[model samples]
Target: MTDTILEVRDLRTSFFTENFEVKAVDGVNFSVPKGKTLGVVGESGSGKSITSLSILRLIQNPGKVVGGQVLFKGEDLLEKSEAQMRKIRGNKISMIFQEPMTSLNPVYTVGQQIGEAFQIHEKLNKKESIKRSVRC
Candidate 1:
């Protein structure tokens, strides 16, 4: 079996504004092998975050993945349907934003929010998810 866990080939993501287009990620490529890690370091606006977002298919509207493929365990994530992506996200593939607290809803407790993620990704009941979240 191959030790390659992820392979991003010629990924290109862009944003279309009314006046112009911004190519956040143009032909980016890399891979993460089993028992290995990869870190991206660059100046701000160098498409670091955008690359991660694209890999997860989380690019917001106005920004889209224009080309290339993200192979995770030999499956092309770019070709997966939204429903399929939903199942893979947070379960098989996960990401942590730079400032994660900003991603959380202030109205919800941190545990509760994490519990929701656990419930959605693991198909655990609310009570069980909440319990698991608390333990973490």
Candidate 2:
């Protein structure tokens, strides 16, 4: 059996404004197997970013996920509470922003920033986190 790591089903997200509503994402679906890579590609404004944001439950005010199921390891992320999602983000799943300059902190080195995840999720010390960060 192919081990399915992540699956997205019928995701729908919309932005609400006083004037009108914009359907940013609608009826998106995909699956990623374990130890595999999935790339999202589309023209600009084709709901690529919106679909990703909806999967991560990162849609902010004026925008909402209308429908969908985001399953990670067979667990429904769309049903998870905010606190639960916090534990999953970065630890279980992560997104590399398209622009590194904006995503990365100016003061910290790349290793320090990457190692921070190990410190938080794996409970490793600064020394160990830095050590592990460089190995990859």
Candidate 3:
């Protein structure tokens, strides 16, 4: 069998609100093979964002990834250290938000922001980085 690139098994995420506990992701399970994509389609508040955030371990206080395993290339992502996950977050797996204006920093030039990606992952020098960033 082909190896699984990403596996999320029985994932559960919850938020402790002032009055009650809100279950954002309830026992969600899926696997994506290499070079494949999984589109999660749901209405707002259907746990789409929470599920993605949980995969990256970015869910903050009040909401937490309470259960399940996030395996990337057969490794348990939930068990990875923050530093390790930081390396993976953008390098191995990159996310582009729906709103580009908001995603980019107004203070920084577009080239600067894009160059940061190459700098972090590929360790490109400034001149070459800007060139590649512009191409991106």
Candidate 4:
């Protein structure tokens, strides 16, 4: 059987605005075993994306992972330094942003934007990945 590659325990992410606090992700727990895939499904604003952002330590200003732990290969990612996280971010771990178009450059075609993404994790050249993306 495959071992647990990633586990999240009681993850809570919060956003603070002038008016009040929004608990985007609260008390979330899950695990992904090696050689396995997990799917998270819920209605909009149900904190699905927020939980992922927290696990990746990509929570931005006004939003923070207030509590809980993200364990990757038995190492607590929450305890890792930013430099350590940086190394892990591109190599050991990665993410696919939810919206493709929002960040796509207006002048570039969708294939061009997606090709850059393949360059990131898949290590394909712009020409090859762009061709692959366009075909898809």
lDDT per residue, candidate 3, 4-122, as tens digits? 89999999999998899899999999999898878999998898888988998889999989899999998888999999998998788777766778888899887888788788889
Candidate order by decreasing lDDT = 1, 2, 3, 4
- How do the residues 1-136 of candidate 1 rate in per-residue lDDT, one tens digit apiece? 6799999999999999999989999999999998898988999999999999999999998999999999999999999999999999888887877786687788987778788878998788988988999887
Residue-level lDDT tens digits of model 4 in 1-136 = 3499999999999999999989899899999999899999999989888888888898998998899999999899999999888778846776877776774578988678767656776789889989878776
Model 4 stretches with alpha carbons more than 4 Å out: 106-136
Greater lDDT among 1 and 4 belongs to 1
Clash pairs detected, candidate 4: none
What are the per-model numbers of colliding residue pairs? 0, 0, 0, 0
Q: Which lDDT values do the candidates have, in the order given?
A: 0.91, 0.90, 0.89, 0.85
Model 3 poorest 10 in a row by lDDT: 90-99
Per-candidate TM-score against the hidden true structure: 0.89, 0.92, 0.88, 0.77
lDDT of 2 at 63: 98
User: With candidate 3 superimposed using the best TM-score fit, by how many Å does residue 97's alpha carbon deviate from the native?
Assistant: 2.2
Tell me the spans in candidate 3 whose CA falls farther than 4 Å from its real position. Answer: none
